[model samples]
Target chain A: MSIPADLKYTKSHEWVRLEADGSVSVGISHHAQELLGDMVFVENPTVGRKLVAGEECAVVESVKAASDVYSPIAGEVVAANGDLEGAPETLNQDSYAAWMFKLKPANAADLDGLMDATAYAAHVASEAH
Target chain B: MLKQTPLNAKHHEANAKLVDFSGWEMPIHYGSQVEEHHFVRNDAGMFDVSHMLPVDIKGEGARAFLRKLVANNIDKLQTTGRALYTCMLHEGGGVVDDLIIYFMSESWFRLVVNAGCADKDLAWMEVQRDKLAPKLSITPRRDLAMIAIQGPNAAAKLWAAMPGTRELAEAMKPFHAVVVGEMFVARTGYTGEDGFEVMVPNKAAPFFWQALLEAGVKPCGLGARDTLRLEAGMNLYGQDMDEGVTPFDSGLAWTVDMSGERDFIGKDALSRLPRNRQLVGLKLLDRGVLRGHQSVFTAQGEGEITSGSFSPTLNGSIALARVPVGIKVGDTVEVDIRGKRMKAAVVKYPFVRNGKALV
Candidate 1:
């Protein structure tokens, strides 16, 4: 339910935050984590790997089911959260703060193409039915 | 609209995440499923299992009727409040459903059957009653609600929440039940942990649930229940075995009483059928989650995982699979997970019990 004003989100619930280095840190949205429930394993995309927008790049598994994490924008993965391998529940605790991977956007303008906070909130609201 | 249980409002008030289970609107979790699973394993947790149906059989022919209907010998239930877990099967030896029958008296018995299989089971039971024991009367008790309190501290929590229950249930061993007023407290649970499955009047369900909550028993949902039962090596009626399979193939041969000379519903067909595939436990040697219907490749032949999950108790993935009869404990098998063959070891099931991992 907490959709930060600064972060952009994908329809699939991935959140993108523009970091200080111009590289954007990406993770699943708070709503995504809530729906998935208590993540037990997070398979983060490898660093230095190139990804296309909307590609299934990683997996986040919960006790109930396994879900594919899609890339919000095309980019080269700069860093993967190694901490997730040992403690995946951190994502469930604070999804916005626990970034899954850092990406150097292939086209920085692609960030604007994703849904903003208002749009993402509406998208989530529409899904409830 | 999905069917709702008597405690549906109580679950919503607890902020449960509701999901469509079979035809019923049931809670999948109240919060973190892993935490709920741990609560039931370590402390105490309660589940609103009112979706299941309770049927009562009464008359002089009640005992005689069940003996011919189920695969397991019901005559073994000699003492009052003694329960028997058995599979009701078809003439072809396929499982109709698995149920728990409690011997309340010489002429009266209680049966708790799965929610999904209730209607079909009733119809099947009626058919058998008309053909065999026409004198018995079977009545479905829809006015009752069921709650399962599980874990190491489950009994203490129950005693504290409902006063005087300790006196009635303290000495009750596993598979035994005691009637305290209108509540039927059975020392039985799907989870490997010690607990009781209490049945009470539908109107009192909310009050009982609130009392348990105040007693420090956490509210768990079906998600944790499935994981706990899976780790305990319990067979789920539809997932682990169904109308397509018999008890011998579902890791439930021990529950089937074929040793007796008495004939049961599926006895004749089970005797003639060849036991080719058998259920075995799987411990993932490598990373990844094992899910139901996933293909399994043994040294002898191919098979399928009946029920699989990430076991919270063991902190690893485990599964129950039906593989070729040649596969044994300590053998290695490859599971086709998302098109990749992942290495897994075949081990004796109950991967976890009493907060300890056996494999």
Candidate 2:
């Protein structure tokens, strides 16, 4: 799957979409969910929780193992996807569509530090070999 | 640098996600592991299990050698083609390996052991054979390849692949083996499904695997195999019990024969040891997945999960935990998943069988 050119990505495989209201929607990248096959349980960051950049804020458990979903930037979680509690497979179907949480960025400049679609796509390809 | 099975090329052709399992390069999944798992439970799926070693024992001392070698009594193997599940143990009562012993003849028996423990098991067996049954021959058949076709529809699929072999396979009881041409087919599997574990010559394996695939048998992998076996309440050799743990604590005491007059390798040590912990099944009451080495908190005492997975059939996390012996079925315990303690119910296992949930 091609990386969405519009979204920013983290090295840990989390993707962040800058929203119109300055809050950012965060979810795992398509490649991340593909690597971790069959999501069984997903625990999103609780709303109102303050998360530092690179903080392990959420968890995604697949049939094989559980992995932490790190926060891509310093932020406070404003909302979380409640649908994931009962339907975790949505992430498997379309990871970008199934956003885990929305965060209000503490510093908007932090978004520029993340990899662009080209750099992220290159990183993913490099890891494959 | 990794060992390749006979079906290695076939797995690559199928675009399987190959992973380094122990020292062998084996497929972890073909596509979606969940889909592969569901295929095994609902229809049919096949796994390349050639990495596991098959040792053929022959001689007049074969039975006597095995009688003193394993915890389960070889005396129970009365008929030809019958199979017995047993644990080979160290002198300290710790499990050397868990294996399936097939009574092929009075003087000929076959033992299939875990791939990772093959060398260790053979070395241990050779020691016993040298000491007590010097005449017995233990041969590890690396020339053979094994494939497990499992699920409710497995028999029909196998028959489709190997025409006219249906009657032979269907006639054999569970845990029974039959030789059809060059293939040694056993009505046995690690998955808790009606299936066959066929051992064929390494040269013929890729062809047979392709034939089965053409017969509509989905190619499963080690990922599905783990979930299926965990649901079946089967113990994984290295994770569930190893050289440091006894069979009594691994939910294999029934396979151990204490009532008989047989004197097995670890009988003396086992008889004297007091049982403190016992293996039990756990169904997650909370959301997170249970995994190996996770701490278990029971009223009786703290314990640990030996083999745990997200059960596809049950749609929940399940585990085989070694807890205080006092814990019984229906008792609720807490499993420490990372930092949080999650509720899990202790239950009798073989959690799912024949496409149905038991617990």
Candidate 3:
């Protein structure tokens, strides 16, 4: 239930962090990884690939089921976390630390359109029922 | 509201993630499904299988009625307490449901059917009972609750959990049930491990579950159960086959009894119809996990995967598929997994047995 106020989130459960280099790192949220429970495989979008907002650019498969990781905003994938290829369960250990991929935003202003910690927390609550 | 088992509270207390399975609110996993699967293979684990119903058939013509109702011959049970794994078929050769019949006496017998098909099975049994043996009593034992404790050390843990009942079950053989007071303990399990499927009254389930937990038996959910059963090469009732397919093509032909003159339901259809499909196991050589409903490509023709999962015991993906009859073991098949055709090898099933890999 740790929603770091520093990062932003999408309704589909991907969290985005604006790094010091102006690039954004994206990964599934703690809630998403918790629901998935025990990751078995992680497939990141190809590096240097263009992505549209809300596009399914990655995948996170757990022992229970597979889930699509949607891109929060339009961007070009700069780096895919090759580390996850060997250890996908690192997300279960620490989701925020295990970023799936990083992107160079198409429009940095689009970050404002995404939900903050409070809004995303409410979005997660709305789904419980 | 979905149905809840007597041990539902226990599952919640153990911090289980609950899911709606076949109209019943059951636990899919306690915490980690893969970890639970391994624990059951290495040690002892227990499952609350109360959703599955038991039917007690009692009367002078009980055995005679069952002989006509199911596909496999019940005449093979020469002694009391023996259990036979078989399928109940419709008027045609299609499987109505797969069940285990336990012979308690000449006039008394018990059957355990899948949870999802309990109502339909009960209705079918009643219809057949009225026509064949009006003097028979077909009773659904919903009052009883069942729990399966399994693993290599399952017996020792069970003996430690409940005292005094050990001596009654100590000398029991596999596929046999010994009733002690109100508890019916069977030396059979869905997992390939050695253990007992103990059935007791609903009120006593909580106590037994607690005792077993205190004895260090880890609580497992359906998630682990599915993987374990898949590894053991056991067929699920709905996912594997239904009223549209018979046991002949569902890897259950050995369970069908055309060996004797015993006339049963769907016997003529089984004899007359041509079985051009066969169920075989698949070992994935690709990266992704194999799952159900995926299309399979074979040298003979097209096929479909019935059940598939990542086998925790083998640390690889395996599946059961229904393919054209010509497919043989060691043959290669490609499975369409998320639109990607991955190479998989066709092999004999029961991929893992007795806590060891066979494929």
Candidate 4:
């Protein structure tokens, strides 16, 4: 429900925060964590791994089920959240702060293609019905 | 639309995260399922298990009818208010459902059966009653609501919430039930903890649930119920044993009551069929979690994990697998976790009991 206006989102529930630098920090949305319940394990994409847009780059598994974390846009993974391996529940606690990985965008313009806060909120609302 | 329990609106009011469970809209959790699981393990917790069905059998021939209906020897239930856990099976020896039968009197018995299979179970019981005991009356008590209060301190906490229940239930042993007016309290639960499953009239359920919450018993959901049951090595109805699997292969042979003189519905088929598989517990030596339907490789042959999960108590994965009868305790088996063949040790279940790790 807390879709920050400064952030962008994908239909699959990944959120992206564009940094001052060229890199963008990406994590799952608050809605995503709520749906998945308590996360037990998070497998993030390795640094330097090149991913195409919408590629399944990582997996976040809860006690109930596992879900693939898809890449919002084509990019090279610059950093992986190693802290998650020890405590995956961090994503459940503060998903916006506990970014899964950093990506150097392959096409920076792809960021505009993702849903902004207003559009993403509408998308989430539509899903309820 | 999914089926709703009598307490469904109450769960929604408490902000429960609801999910579709076998066509019923049930609460998976309120917030954190792990916290709920830990709460029940450490303190008291309550679950609105009204989705489970309670059927009442009344008549002069009630005892005789149940004697031939279920696999367990209900004749053992001589004392009033005594409860027995038993399996109902098909003619092919496949499991129909597992249920708890409470003997209130010679003419009246109460059966609590799983929610998903209630309709099928009721029809089956009706057919059997017609053929075996035409005088018996079969009544489905959907008008009742069930709540399970479970944990080490559950009984005392429930007593605190509903005064006078402790004195009434204190003398009752495990698998016993006592009726206090409209409230029927039973000293039984699926969780491996000292607890009570209370059945109250449908209209009074919400008030009782609120009282329990005010008494500081955490409201747990089905997600925690599953993990706790798995850790306790209890067999889930559809997952562990279904119409495809027999009670003999599901580690429930003791409940079959084959030695009893009374002839049950599935006795002849069970006696004639040879059991080639046996259910056993597996403790994973590897790092991954074990889950249902995972293939298991043993020296004898291949088997399947019927119920598996990460044990919050053991801090590792454990499973109940149906393996070849040749396998023994302490034998090593390989489970296909992802693409890796993980080594696991076979042992007798339950992996934990009464807040202590047994294996």
Give me the candidate number with maximum DockQ: 2
Clashing pairs for model 3 are: none
Instruction: For each candidate, report what fraction of the true interface contacts it reproduces.
Output: 0.86, 1.00, 0.50, 0.50
lDDT of 3 at A72: 96
Per-residue lDDT of candidate 4, residues B304-332 (tens digit):
99988767788777899999999999999
Off by over 4 Å in 3: none
* Listed models, DockQ each: 0.82, 0.93, 0.68, 0.58
Q: What are the per-residue Cα lDDT tens digits for candidate 3 across B144-203?
A: 999999999998999999876799998899999989999999999999989899999999
Clashing residue pairs in candidate 2, if any?
A: none
Q: What residue runs in model 4 are displaced by over 4 Å at the alpha carbon?
A: none
Worst 10 residues of 2 chain A by lDDT: A38-47
| Model 3: per-residue Cα lDDT over A1-129, one tens digit each | 569999999999999999999899999899999898878878888989999999998888887788889999999999999999789889988888899999999999999999999999999999999
Docking class of 1: high
When only the first chain is scored, the TM-scores of the models are 0.97, 0.98, 0.98, 0.97
Where in model 2 is the C-alpha error above 4 Å? Answer: none
Q: What DockQ would candidate 2 receive versus the native complex?
A: 0.93
Q: Which candidate, 1 or 4, has the higher TM-score?
A: 1
**Model 1: lDDT of residue B178:** 84
TM-score of each: 0.98, 0.98, 0.98, 0.95
Candidate 2 docking band = high
Q: What lDDT tens digits, residue by residue, belong to model 1 across residues A1-129?
A: 569999999999999999899999999999999988888888988898999999999999988789999999999999999998889899988999999999999999999899999999999999999
